[model samples]
Target: MKSVTRSLRILEAVAQHQPVTVGELTKLFGLPKSTVQRTLVTLNEAGWLRANRKDTTRWEIGARVLAVRPAALQGSSLFAAAREPMIRLRDAVNETIHLSVPDALQCMVVVDRVDCTHAVRTFHAIGDTSPLHATATGRAVLAHLPQADVEELLERGLERFNEDTPTDAEQLRAELRKVRADGYSVNRNQYRPDVCAVAAAILDEAGTPLATVAVSMPDSRYDATRLPELGRLVAETAQEIAGRRDGA
Candidate 1:
């Protein structure tokens, strides 16, 4: 079991920092050189890691990892469950509604959407990852994560995208607490200037965060005065999605 754990850790480290060398891995994990080399060899043979023939000493993640991801994600009911609610939320708010799922340590957008009324508006593309401390959708998902995971993210530190982005861990934690109490999160020009968003988490039967549903609009359309109402709509929509998933 310890060997398996170490092997998985090596795989995770490689995945997180691809095209890494054994020496880098040894330095990063403080592991013995021979152990890292042997683990890499086993993983490479199992097709979980790929090595460059031109530079056999370096390695990157293998294609097998990505091949399994789509299948697993397809098995999830989030897409089917969120499609209608996303459309309705977009129409109700005359804005874009996005569905994002946690991918590794970040949240990635699985759907890009816009209301017919706002067809010209720019929208986040599917597969775009939101900053955890800079966007409402990201914060909503983070608010539901385990405290350990949250602390890990904080220790990694927040990346600043704009003036409103929270770079302080304590402040971000306070905001997450507020989100937990209010059942929704709001971001105003934290990610994109002149844009605003409100988001809430869709929970699974186990009360785990399945995804985040968010409505985004221009600051002109969704100002501070209307944030509470927008937040309520997002929370209700997320709850409905969660309930349907639980029932299913």
Candidate 2:
């Protein structure tokens, strides 16, 4: 367990000072150079750290490490506000409910839920980050961001999460325009195949989108007949939450 603690300490040091070298890590942790090198190698093998492909002397946290921070946001007030609403939505629709907030450059899930009666459900965890152009929750929040911020994010580029995910900036911008006009967003198999999601922006007193609320289910369960109802409920719930915040 001592060795494990040392490994975790190394990880925390790297996370705190990114793009660090083995020599710098050794100095920071007061460990021998050989010990730092061995720990870095082990971490690299475990997908927690990776040598900079361009400059082999430096290292950076890997995708696996990036994947863990979103989970840690679950205890935040943003998560607290969305939890009960998500649970209620899940029970009402007998589907999955997801709550997400805009992190620096991505949409991070704060809450994930599934109704007990639903035999088939998408099991997204609390820490997942979905593409801004793919998930309905992302689109809903993105639609409300400032145009300059939107342009900056689009310039950073969009990755296709699934075949249906939109990678074209112009197309996504146009779609976001429509979402702004309609006050909600809907996505089908954009992030995960066979799943459909509808989302609306949860606004604060100043009308800023503080978070997003989304309901997701298998395409079979959220067919054309049921989608409109689900979308309406999602939007209403978001508006209701916004109303409560304004009143308070």
Candidate 3:
């Protein structure tokens, strides 16, 4: 029974400070390194936690947790508000639409998705996470965040996923400025190679970003000439979702 309780506490700590290291978790829980490592291994085996893709030494929440409590992760009202608009966006653009919320300034967590009919469309599991500096969905949320918060996130060191990823702080800051000015963000093979996307953030009454809505597709089907239209549609869908969420 004590072991179960300890494991549960460790899981909560991992979710709160995710992409965390075993050494860090041990220090946080005042447990021996061996004990913490054992618990993490147990959780990983149970599908409640997994090592970060970029840095295997760190851990993050797993898809099984999202699969088990989808409604809670979806934030009931936000899910309902985003559903129809996301569907409409996918139908309009014939690309997958994703709704993702910021996980602190660390990453964006995909909470919902409407898939396109294309056999080769881009895909992200509901619990998937991506860096704020490398994804259209992540940048859409990052662009609206406060300057201090953005700076703090930049200080964390952006991990490069592809040659096109903007790892320099100044370069990413400029891109965030563009996202703010254009009311949308575009990513081309930045996070995931050969995937392209356009996205806009859903803002609350205080103008704080609550989540982001993105239209994603494979580069093979992406048309540079359609960017303006795609950006407009994505931005409009984000606004519609925000309005519905507030009204709900």
- The candidate that wins on lDDT is 3
Name the 10 consecutive residues with the lowest summed lDDT in model 1. Answer: 103-112
Choose 1 or 2, whichever is better by lDDT.
1
For all predicted structures, in order, the TM-scores are 0.70, 0.69, 0.78
- Relative to the unseen true structure, what is the C-alpha lDDT of residue 129 in candidate 2, on a scale of 0 to 100? 68
The best-first sequence of candidates by lDDT reads 3, 1, 2
Q: Give the Cα-based TM-score of candidate 2 against the true structure.
A: 0.69
Residue 211 of model 1 has an lDDT of 81
| Candidate 2: Cα lDDT at 53 | 49
Task: List the candidate 3 regions with Cα displacement exceeding 4 Å.
Answer: 9-69
lDDT of 2 by residue, 1-248 (tens): 98899999988888788788998988888998999999999999986888864577988776556556555655655555566766777778777787666653445454445454667777677657677778898889888888887887788789888778989999899989988887789999988888888899998867778878888778777677776788788998788756654554
lDDT of each: 0.79, 0.77, 0.89
Clashing pairs in 1: none
lDDT of 3 by residue, 47-74 (tens): 7888886688999987557555656856
Model 1 TM-score, all chains together: 0.70
Which residue pairs clash within candidate 3? none
